[model samples]
Target: MKEITRIIAFYETLKRKADVACALAMVVYVEGSSYRRTGARMLVSEDGFWEGGISGGCLEGDALKKARMAILKSKPELVRYDTTKGDDNQIGVGLGCNGVIDVLFIPVDFENENNPIEILKKSFENNNKPLVVITNSLKEPELLGKLFYFESKQSIDFLKNHLDVGLFSEEILALEKSKNYNIDNELRLFVEILPKPITVYLFGNQYDIYPLIELLKMLYWEVRIVSEPNKIQNRENLTIIAPSDFSENLLNKNSAALLMSHSLEIDKKNLRKLTTSTVKYIGMLGPKTRSERILNELAAEGTKIDSNKIFAPTGLDLGASTPEEIALSIVAELKAVFSGRNGGFLRERELPINERNQEIFKFN
Candidate 1:
């Protein structure tokens, strides 16, 4: 969600500048170690301003140059960066993690109906799910810059006249099984399937809670503020009454919730209300003692809470003291939880940070 938002924001900015053409750089394939993986995108304006990043600073300068050429030629181009040489570097990180990256830069016009970013922005803004976007970088002056988008959940009747019906059918079937991003060079397609962001329910209305709200919004996660009807401002994504208030309405089954009302009584009540819920994650803001006390009260009440899903003294041990830093820690936890990580140091992990797609293809 944040990725799509970044593209939209940069495109809007470029549209405001007079005679400022734009190009989007996206990582199509990664050979070894790269900071960002396939589907990572960066938007570069002819004026040198850019948003997002395809790689650590190592690749942006080179990408900016390619973007300028792309804008001038008004043609999409695939640029390769081979940092496998020990001497080759991009802002120091690439030297440590040498990799080969294929970046495709496509000129963009915001007003154009077929613009890829515009299409993507609409999909995200509308909260459309399972949007599969395919680009054939190898076919310049043809499908190189063009994109094929489909709502994978629906029957693709429009695909009858599609330029690559067989290709679409094969990949769509594959997608139904794995439902992940794929860089199929043999098919000449850089396929990216955008999934829905995880939903979160924040059960608080305190001033400090505002910081958390800000962070979540930046991540483009759908957050529902569950509280008293009069406690919260009528925001677009906020829910005034708690889900427990109405049995028919429940929090997203695959969601995380935070309990931080600043009042012990209210927090305890919330814990009790959500005790039996299938909502996997229940985060309580405060010291371990406070959370334990709440649990003790709930236990005495004969409520059976899923102890494994409860996160007391929520957030990583980041030594966070300020409200903003605390908010960062909390959101970090949520991200780690969503990815099934322990929120620990990345260096400790043996696997790549960007989970590699098991399905592999090589470009000839």
Candidate 2:
């Protein structure tokens, strides 16, 4: 979700600089194992330019057609694509794509009043701000509505309804303390209190770290560059340290570590302390042979490395070479892991290609 926001901001900025029109599409609901779900976005420009995606190739063709219509009419509409029918040649917007998806296409011009992504982007820029998505559930599927309620640390205001002010406030409170809350009922009017950005610990000052930081920054990640002691600090948000300087107290309150230091000894030393910590991710960047060696060495020293907890050879094997390319591959792998997507190709795996169904979304 955070990455999507950043990408929207980037596109919005580009649109402003280039004076281009862009339409934003979001998948508000999915009935079955569809390619994308609520919050999946695709931004299409006037000249057939696009960034982001709403679904796999299955529904994009239909979306492209609607995007052109939205641009021509300058009025957006809620669209649906149903693939429940087994027929592959079914036409029309609601024809199932072997699954059903409800999408809302909103034409957003930087100068328009209906530019929600841009407004949402502005709200997200301030870490302490909170916003509510007032979706209308009275309709079939869901409608994201033209109104959005937002409250920064300073003010609380509504774009549409003022009667449900109390309900909106309670939702804001829920989002403020959003440790774990079931948000099914709050689909349309889902309130997201923008909390602090997630912290990412990049454990290395190698040549690769530069591009990694750049990519992560573009994704709105709160990155901390951890380098060896006496290492000249270059980045603004960096922490220099010796091998022993690593401490639990130093880890961010909700940080995930990326082990790209390329030093097996330093990596193992930190892993010893981190294995028992509460870090969300500890991705080791290396080949399978080196990763196995580190695991064996940790085991030899009595460190019980949980197989499920570690992501070795961190990032997908996209045959990355240059630093920029490597960073993209690593970010893609991290996103897959975070989103519970198998990094392996769908055709290569025996599991169903679409597992975002109700059966799989269930998590303990």
Candidate 3:
């Protein structure tokens, strides 16, 4: 999310100067292990200036050359890099990543609304829900590099006559993550799902909240404060709301709340309101006993709290003692929770680190 935001900002700057000659390189498919997964993108200009990355710096130099070539030829090109080979001159030589990645470089057409960057910008404009992008990668020159953005059933219905509606609808419904689809050996489509940014609600006015806010901002997540607006500095992606005005309507499934006001009354009041919310993750700052007591009090008052969603004595046990270290621990735990992961040592995990629903569909 952060990388795409930077790419868009850079593209806008270039647009302002009337220098929109560039190419967008995106990792559309990956097999085995990769440093960056599908949907990772980089923008390259004719003069070799670039932003974002598709690899761990090993593939960017070569991707830059390929992107410039695509720009010059005014065509879309799919370049595959197999890192499993041990050849010294190979692109992934020494990385030992043991992956095959397919990158799509599309020359940007500023005049076309269906261009890659324009489609991406459209996705950002309405990010309250997931946006599905279909990129044609093979065979048809007119369709190649063209992007289809689907955020509504109306949009899907509009394309029913032109596409395999059944296959596309099934794939979109079953898409938990991004993948490439091969259609009867005639067409290849990269179906990318772009999710909305995570939102964090900090229900406190304490000084310790600043560190966590900074970390969330770095990740490009939205941060909101449910306390005194004047207590914190106003900045981008940060919203300040008064306690009286804070309501459950401001939260969604992608939202998390951290109660760190250091006051028992404030935490209890906020927790009560959050229990009635659809927000899944709620963290309370303090000792286990205190949080438990607060929950017990709430329970006695006819409020049933979801124990699974509550993280009392919030944050992973990182042996943190200082404010900054505690903030790091909290943010780390939040990431793990949202990603459906346990905050444990990565070396202890048996499966692949980036493994998920990665199955590819072949439609007839």
Candidate 4:
């Protein structure tokens, strides 16, 4: 999400100038193992400026040249890089990643409303709605580089003529991540899913909350400080909401709350408000005994706290003492919880780092 945001910001600056030529390089397909999977993108400008990346530094140089060519010709081109061949001269770099990567370079047309950048901007402004982006990758010349955005079941009607709407609808309904749809080896569509960003509500106004907010912003997650508005210093992209103005309805499955006011009364008050909400995670900043006492009091008052959703003394066991270190631990735990992970060392895991299998569909 942060990469996407940076690309959009850079593109917006180019749009304002209205003279620079730029192309978007996106990894459309990946076979075997690659540093980046599908949907990874980098924006290249004619002035030799680039933002984001498509590979682990080795492929960027070659991708930059291809993107420049695409911009010069004002055409969309697909280039494949085979790294399985252990020759440094192949791409001028020893890419022993044992992977095959396919990249698509599309010149940006500022006038076209359906341009790739424009489509991405729309997806970013989708208000946390899940969006499916269909990009033509093969065979059809006219449809090549063409992009379509679908947000709901009704939007599938637009693709009925070109795709198997039944299967596509099922994929969308199931919330599948992203994959390629191959049709008789003639046409290929990269169906990419853009999910909502994780939202965090900080129920505090203390000094420690600053580091946490900064970390969350660096990850480009939506962050809101739920405290007295006057207590928070005005910062860009950080929303400050008064505690009285906070509502549980604003939270969702992708939302988390951190009670870090360091005040027993304030934490208790916030916990009570979240009891009836549908939030999946509630982190309390303090000792286990303090949080347990609050929970006990709430339970005695018939609050019915969900033990599974509460993380007393929020954060992993990182032996963190400083504010920044503690913030890092808490943010790591939040990511693990949201991803359904146990926050363990990757080296200890027997399975692959990315264990979720991507499914591909075929249609004639």
Candidate 5:
């Protein structure tokens, strides 16, 4: 998964910054079905530190215990988890959902030159991209890792060195675009580079935006506060703008705009501009009736607005009363839209439990 690649990148940065040695576990294959796919990685440290995951739940505890053992033993290992019912209840894992998973525990001492993981990780960091790591070609039809960069001539050589086979750049490019590669009898990994953080534009200096802005910063979102000259405070990632000072062309595709202006003229002007722009989400803080009145006034003045693109009441029905709670509710709605989730209750609905949860894939 790409998240795995990001975690590895963070590790690479950590090791360089703090001089800490780390280890990794790789999930190579699955029999039947598994919660996590092959190529899922878990990083563990000698000091009982850990980050990331291998299987959904079946492999974490064992992987951590074994990884700590690997740190003590100074050896790598290949481990398997069987979900089949066993004689002793404690002997093996019971997934409740059935499946068998095979994971390769590759321990890397960041200080060791012979470590394949360290080399592979370095390749990714140097290139500012993702590297594919192939595990098994026989008895497993899989590949793992994120596509860090587009397929390049250097990647062919990189693959040849790591996988022992000369894969062409054309196929690798195709695999990078697809985000997944099906290599015959091989465990394939394609790692993608991380994108920039999403930008949120808050178009008001109201007190409601304070907690919301704080919440956005807490989630590491890039926030720009578009407000009157004196209204803007000294805050990181914040910009104050007068009515005439706003720029329409510089908005990024992942940018979202919220119009919480207490002034009608300011709200109307921004609404007209944002309605015609490429912002993914344009939320206005008000009741549905107020929103309709604004739209009707705009329509009378010969401007068209897409109803689906605007969120009038601007949050999920979470019964929020406080500014912080309301901010949470709005963020929940934004997250659901960003992640392509339905934003519905699991217990009240008949959706499959797995579907309700954030699962990667479902074979059945």
Candidate 6:
């Protein structure tokens, strides 16, 4: 997400430098498993600065080299990384993530807002709806770099300099549910749905909440601190509000919240609000006994807390004693809940780690 922002933010800078060439790299398709899913992007300027990433680390350097070539030739190219064979370069590189990733490199005209990179960033700017990028070139390559948003009624053009397009409304409408679509034998489309940034609502403005806020920021997510309005500091992408101003309407249904005042009245008040709201996750920071007491109190008040949406004795059991470690644990637990995982050790789970659905695709 930060990478997308970086690309949009640097558009003007790239545009101003007439001689400075830049290339846009996108993970058009992924087979089996990958660290970053399809639609992941990275921007490489002529100055050797890459704003995003396509692979974990194995294929970035190689992609960067290709991006430079794309800039010089003023032509787009396709790059594929298949590490499943267990002998292809990863044999010595030591980092062989078994997966097949298809990346598309396009020379970007940052000056044009209609360019694929700009179009993508603009599509996600104000809309909560998922935007899909259709391509027919990721399979064996040739005519693929075309992009279109379903709602815009745009046509799919695979062999054009710019994607100025229209597909039937019904065709675009159906893609909302499907991830991959095959238009024809030669025109296979890999649909990439754009997602809005995840918002984390941290209830309680304790000193410890600062760490969690900082960490979430690193993940490039939106953070709304529901604490004393006066404690609100000047921060970017952060909303500070007093507990009195808390409202479920202010948040989306997918938002995750953590309750950490450790005060009975405060926790109870927040819990009551959470129990009636549509927000999906509510974490209460305390011991299991403490959680039971709070649940009983709420039960007596006739607002029975839904066990499914609540996380008591909040945070994973990582022997987190320090405030920082506790903050890490709580955030880890929230990340797990957001991804619908148990938040356990990866090694204990399975061998092909990429198979885990770390990031979930939300379909409006």
lDDT of the candidates, in the order given:
0.72, 0.65, 0.83, 0.83, 0.64, 0.70
Query: Which is superior by lDDT, 2 or 5?
Result: 2
lDDT of 2 by residue, 37-65 (tens): 55677887777777778886667777877
The digit string of per-residue lDDT tens for model 5 on 1-364 reads 2454566676777568655555677665565556775556778876666777876665677788878776676665566677755645532455564666666666566676636455555554564344544433344323222223434676556445334333445444444221333444244443333333577888998788989888887776777888776776655556666667777765756788888887777788889988767777888887788877888899999998878768888889999999899899888887777656768886775654332112222111
What TM-score would you give candidate 2 relative to the actual structure? 0.60
Pairs that collide, model 6: 154-166, 155-165, 155-166
Q: How much lDDT does candidate 5 score?
A: 0.64
Clashes of each: 1, 8, 0, 0, 20, 3
In model 5, where is the ten-residue run with the lowest total lDDT? 355-364
Clashing pairs in 2: 82-95, 82-96, 82-97, 83-96, 83-97, 83-98, 135-188, 135-189
Best by TM-score: 3
Residue 11 deviation, candidate 2, in Å? 4.2
TM-score of each: 0.78, 0.60, 0.93, 0.91, 0.71, 0.83
Model 6 regions lying over 4 Å from their true place: 10-12, 84-95, 137-143, 152-178, 232-238, 356-364
Model 4, runs deviating above 4 Å = 87-89, 128-139, 152-162, 234-237, 355-359
- Model 5 RMSD in Å is 5.9
Q: Candidate 4 clashing pairs?
A: none
lDDT of 6: 0.70
Cα deviation of 302 in candidate 2 (Å)?
A: 14
